[model samples]
Target: MPGSITGTIVDPTGAAVAGARVRISHGDQSAEQEALSGDDGQYSLPNVTPGPFQLTITLVGFTTQASSGILRSGENYTVPQIAMPLATAVTEVRVVPSRVEVAEDQIKAQEKQRVLGVVPNFYVSYDHHAVPLAPKQKFELAWKTTVDPVSFGVTGAIAGIQQAQNDFSGYGQGAQGYGKRFGASYANFVASTYIGGAILPSLLKQDPRYFYKGAGSKRSRVLYAIANSVICKGDNGHWQANYSSILGSLAAGGISNLYYPAKNRDGAELTFENTLIGISESAAVNLLQEFFIRKLTRNIPNYEPVSP
Candidate 1:
């Protein structure tokens, strides 16, 4: 003769839990029997084989419950009422920006940076662990620099000084001479800015921005700034030779020979000399940036200093 198992399921509040699944397994090698709790929270497993048996109760939104007992032939095994506890709830959240998106945001912040709120200081990054810019972003920065009002003003000043010194005597004098000088100066600016800051940097997978090292000894900072002229951070975030800026200076100088007077063009010699001068100028500017420029720069973000 077979036995039967019965049980009642309830929630923590002692309310009958309907639709709960109740299963009974015999200790012997026999199939398990299961039943659903009724509206009264009652469940029955009829015709279960006699012997040791286990009952398991389960419901959605509540923890599973289990009980064990032995049954005699033709016995009615009544399991005690099982009270199920509410299951613990869990949630997950994530909000991470892509590399390009992060770089774009950093670029927007950099564009707002100006020395004394007037000169564009867009090339420098105060964030030492700044993300690398895409090629399009590199060109965009170059374009912004070339079109800035201060860039034109600076180019005009350079032309005035050149005209006064008769440095490019080939251009002659008066307004026409000044106009030519201005055009030449502005051309140099555009070529160098695009070639070095955008074109070559994009090709060489290098970054053109000067990363500020605000946390270090004065000697170390100075050396870091000077060394940056010859070596720069690659897109991979590793330091490498700055072929972009070097070759860019040479390329820009060679392009100038086309517009410059025949007497003023020194060919490859002038190109190499100009490249060296550009590197020296970069070192000087970087030194100023490391020691003095940040204090004068406006709208700079409060970024943490990188490890020395």
Candidate 2:
């Protein structure tokens, strides 16, 4: 005798799963029939044969489902609603900024940093693990520092002191002497900045920016700051001997002979001496940066300090 089977399909969320294919077959019989679920998720096999039967439901993007039951003759067999589990998505997504873009953003932030809201503190990077700068970016930073109005003012003040003290005697006294002194002083600044801060750093693949060590014991922080004057982070993010700075200072000092009054030009021995003095000054400045500069600096980014 013929019997009928009926059921509804739904998703795990309990929403109706429309258009699911439903099939039924009698045990020990080759006959099989199929029906699709409607908008209401209902499926029916009205002409199914009586006795034991197997029912299967399948849908695209969902796990196939099956059930078996015995149907009495002419019985209206009703199966429980079939819940279909959707297949897991196999897609992957990844988002990241390019290296150049990341470095550019970091440079923009660094350029805004100033000590006491007036002095440019662009050479220091509070982000110890900063991205490496490209050659172009290194040059750009050096150029910006060289042209800053504050830099010109500082150079003028130094030249004034030199004139007042009658230093660089070859240039003598008067407005002409002051002008020569000013030009020579500005030239020294430009040469040293470009050579040490940009050109050598780019060629040696070194980071020119001082990495601030803002946390740790006072002694350790002091040591870290002083050490940074001689040891610097490389483009590969490892500490290395600061050949860029050392060599750049030597180069700048050697170049200074060309522009400065011959009497002021330090010979090889005194040039080396002056280089040592410069390095000591760098160490002192770095110590100040670690202990005090950030507090006084305006527009500083909030970065967690890195430990040695």
The lDDT values for all models are 0.93, 0.91
lDDT of 1 by residue, 154-237 (tens): 999999999999988999999999999999999999999999999999999999999999887888998999999999999999
Each candidate structure's count of clashing pairs: 0, 0
Cα TM-score per model: 0.73, 0.73
Q: Model 1 — which ten-residue stretch has the worst lDDT?
A: 20-29
| Residue-level lDDT tens digits of model 2 in 1-308 | 77788899999999998999998877567588999999999998887777888888999999999988988888999999899999877898888998888999998999899999899999999987889999899999999899999999999999999999998899999999999999989998998899999999999999899999888899999889889889899999899999988888889889989988877878999889988888899999999999999999998888999895
lDDT of 1: 0.93
